[model samples]
Target: MTAPTLTETLPARETARSWWGDAWLVMTRELTPTLRDPFSVVFGLVQPLVFLGLFGPLLAGSVGATVPGGDVWAWFVPGILVMTTLFGTSTTGANLLFEMQTGAHERLLVTPLARSAQLVGRAGKEMAPVVAQSLLVVLVMLPFGFAPHPLGVLAGLVLLAVFGVGVGSLSYALAIAVRQQDWMFWAVQQTLLFPLLILSGMLLPLETGPRWMQVAADANPLRYVVDAERALFAGDLASATVAWGAVAAALTAALGLVVGVRTLSRSTR
Candidate 1:
């Protein structure tokens, strides 16, 4: 009897297309769960508003008149947007952990879905809500006299979305690697969420902070995000701040995607 021939694998192009399709399906399914949770959506929408309204006025007098082109509340608005995105994205990992515990992740792995597609889809689904939250922050900021250059505002929003997806992916990966839903939930808040917020220049300018803190902020991608937002609001599109911010956001996304997939694969195995 003749030896059996081995089957040839699909080309990379075809593989990528297949993965993309699977990702889309998963993304759609994931969205349904979020949509059904009206309380989640409502809370996500309201919290940012509360933060902006409460804090904006409180600090306006102190930082508003002191900083260059201050309008402290306006400057703080972008930070709130970033904060909203970060919180919204970070919590997504908890759901992923739940799925893993419930055997949903195992089912997904046994299917023909590409690992990357599954990871991207999960992160993307979380991103949609973040984008909505960020936009609502912008609207809330408008009446407070925060005006971004129209085109720059659009660019900043796009960057924020990309950044959120990346950070969220990273958080999901951490959650998976830990494999404890409650622990992941707390860790996301303690490890990733709070550090990024405090170091990111959200509440205050980096220049005004202590030397070591400023250095740390400089190294933080979140700082760049706030810088980009600040530049957009000032109508200074060509500034180095926005350019660096975009670069940092892109790098974070790329690195996070890689780490997330690896973590998910190992966990599944």
Candidate 2:
């Protein structure tokens, strides 16, 4: 029998770095479609600006700087950042659903890439836009006097990214499980958006709500992200609650990644 070719004979080292490299390639390729699409690229930047410009002033009085150590805009800034990340991350599932429906995903599966790599790549691509949105929120907040400690701001940004990754991975799984794109959109909006928005300290401070809401907020991962952002922007170092929140958010993302990889594996089969 002929010996295997050199390319085929070499051991496939599926290390973390290799997986990350594959994911980076996938992310780069995936980003082209998003960048080329004018609406998506524009909306990603514009939506948050509109929200901040319109709602920031309108709600400023109602959520005035009297409630706690932080000002109204400081609290609002973090929530807006979360909202921006959500919009960017949640829509990623639709792109995956489109690819799955069009057989693009199948084409990718024929390669030597591991299923986890594919999932991570797709997820990493989705996170790119969220990162952009988070940055934009920080820029917008700077003018409004929302300034967190340097380290705190960095931690908050990291947490936001982690939260988005977890949420996006979960949404991607749901998108694949469903048959149609519209249903995926609806489900994400209804199930993921409202709960995270309401329960998290996004629209309002968790302390301002009822006892049950406070408990629910404590359990919500997004709450930690919002808190981290709020604490950072408000320069409330002593009150910073993001260390535990970051740990929780990272754990959640890791779990979501595992679940997403399993789901993708099964679906491809």
How do all models score by TM-score?
0.87, 0.84
Error of 1 at 105 (Å): 1.7
Kindly give the stretch of ten consecutive residues in candidate 1 with the minimal lDDT sum. Answer: 4-13
- Give the per-residue lDDT digits (tens) of candidate 2, residues 111-170: 877778888887777666776667756776687787656776666677778877877787
Q: In model 1, where do residues sit more than 4 Å from their true spots?
A: 1-17, 37-39, 180-185
Total backbone clashes of model 1? Answer: 0
* lDDT per residue (tens digit) for residues 86-106 in model 1: 877877777877877788878
Candidate 1: how large is its RMSD? 4.5
TM-score of candidate 2 versus the correct structure, residues matched by position: 0.84
RMSD of each: 4.5, 3.6
Point to the candidate with the largest TM-score: 1
Candidate maximizing lDDT: 1
Residue 254 local lDDT, model 1: 89
